[model samples]
Target: MKTDTLFKRAFNDALLLTSRLRDGDPIPSETTLAAELGVSRTTVRKILQTLTEQGVVAGAGRSRFARASAGEVQPFPEAETVPTSVQVEKQFMEWMLRGDAKAGALINELDLARQFKVATTVIREFLNSFQRFGLIERRPSGGWVLQGFTHSFALELFEIREMFELRSAREFSSLPGTSPLWHELRRLRQEHIELLSEIETRFQDFSDLDSRFHRLVNTAVPNRFIDGFFDIITLIFHYHYQWNKKDERERNEVAIREHLAYIDALLSRSRSAVATACRRHLASARQTLIRSTSDTGSVA
Candidate 1:
């Protein structure tokens, strides 16, 4: 399955490169193509062989040339290129975020597999991994049950989250101007601004953007442990957003503004400013999560 995914991705990339060439343009050499496509020469050779068979390219070895015009070559379908595990994870997260599964809800592997259109084994494995976080548990009768966020869970999670994020934010502020992360940070800041402009109708969109912004901050100083913890953070916050709908638009708007302040602090390269902004935003988020969980009777 891994090899098939790699080949399909490379094949799609080769198709894209081919589409850019004139009908008779010489194909790049195996080494150059491999480097450009980030694949092994063997994979590149396979791609060239397949392209030749499909009449997309002509000739053999170093003598290859394009035979198809830009309009003629078709890339693989987008869905075919994504790994099955990724597809399952995305679908499962979407299911949770859509509030299809409430806190403490029973999770049936067969039902989720059917709902997600994947093998039941896939769902089982995903749940098993997720179970380690204490968010879910196995039942003796069969199936798993969600352990919804409670006030204590919110406090504990935020305690670690704050430590990780503050360290990352400080690291981010000290990044050299040439770092590409600066460019990404700028791009996300603009996205926050745009989302804030349409906050009333686009409020739901903030969940994704919120996740991206924090994830980017952590990239400044990557820690595998922090990275893993973020998976839980992302899921729980997504659940929080879905489960707590009171003043949803207003709440999101405030968060967006706080994010802008945080971004400005990072961009300023002021360590003190970064710390202040980070603390303020995290404090607000902690309170929000605690308040929401406290009000929800479902939490245990």
Candidate 2:
């Protein structure tokens, strides 16, 4: 079976097996399912989680899943679709970009919690992730203080980002036609084209779109360590750059075209071509970061 079919086949097989079993009947472990279905345990786990989410399965522990009472699977509502954590991150980034807060300013967790309409723990988790990069630090007195960086910091981060993405491009070049990545790339490419066609009205949305595009590209590889760095990169390049609105629309239009080129190169599955495309886009992002630092006129 094709890699794309692995997921659906697992889900369907699990559903079929569950249909014949009583509610109290034990479901197989992820390891058992993966072995039986010839799929990865990761894939099996994902399907099980979906089944649980859709009310087809029940149990808190991974080892305890069993069929739920028979009922129609609820179609998840499109509204309230964004995960609380993701929405929190978005709002927090926006809060920073909107200049509601500033570099060197103290970040009050309770204040942020109220602003984001989330618990203080969620706010702490969001900020704590950035603490790894020294982007934010806890004040000796109390709350967290947002840290500012010199231009060198941005350049260094970009260098690491380029290395990871170039490797990702090389890996992506070898993916088979049945890879789910192709479907994602096609969808994102269409989105790029649509946004470019309406650039006059939609250019401001490019920052978010650019973040998504790069995030998707980096996700092609299975590097867990890079995930944390990617989050900081996304926050800085995508949202931080919003501080400077000079030539914003034109810059965004150019970025949209560049993204389309990157998507095209990936689809061609040519390592050299993808490398060139990736280099070009990363260079653009680095330049944008430098410009943002200059606009802010702050260095630490």
> Which candidate has the top score in TM-score?
1
Best by lDDT: 1
TM-score of each: 0.68, 0.57
Q: Candidate 1: lDDT of 55?
A: 91
lDDT of 1: 0.84
lDDT of 1 by residue, 62-92 (tens): 6889986523656778888887777786777
Residue 150, model 1: lDDT of 51
Residue 267 CA displacement from its true place in model 1, Å: 6.3
Residue pairs clashing, model 1? none
For candidate 2, write residues 1-300 as lDDT tens digits: 112444665667677777777776777887887898777989988888888787777775655556657586544343344556677877875665455666778888999899888788888988877577755688887778865554656777888999998988888778889989889989999999999999999888888888887778777777887888777786676556556678889888888888888889999988888999889988986887776663232521
Model 1 poorest ten-residue lDDT run? 291-300
Stretches of candidate 2 exceeding 4 Å from the true structure: 1-129, 137-146, 294-300
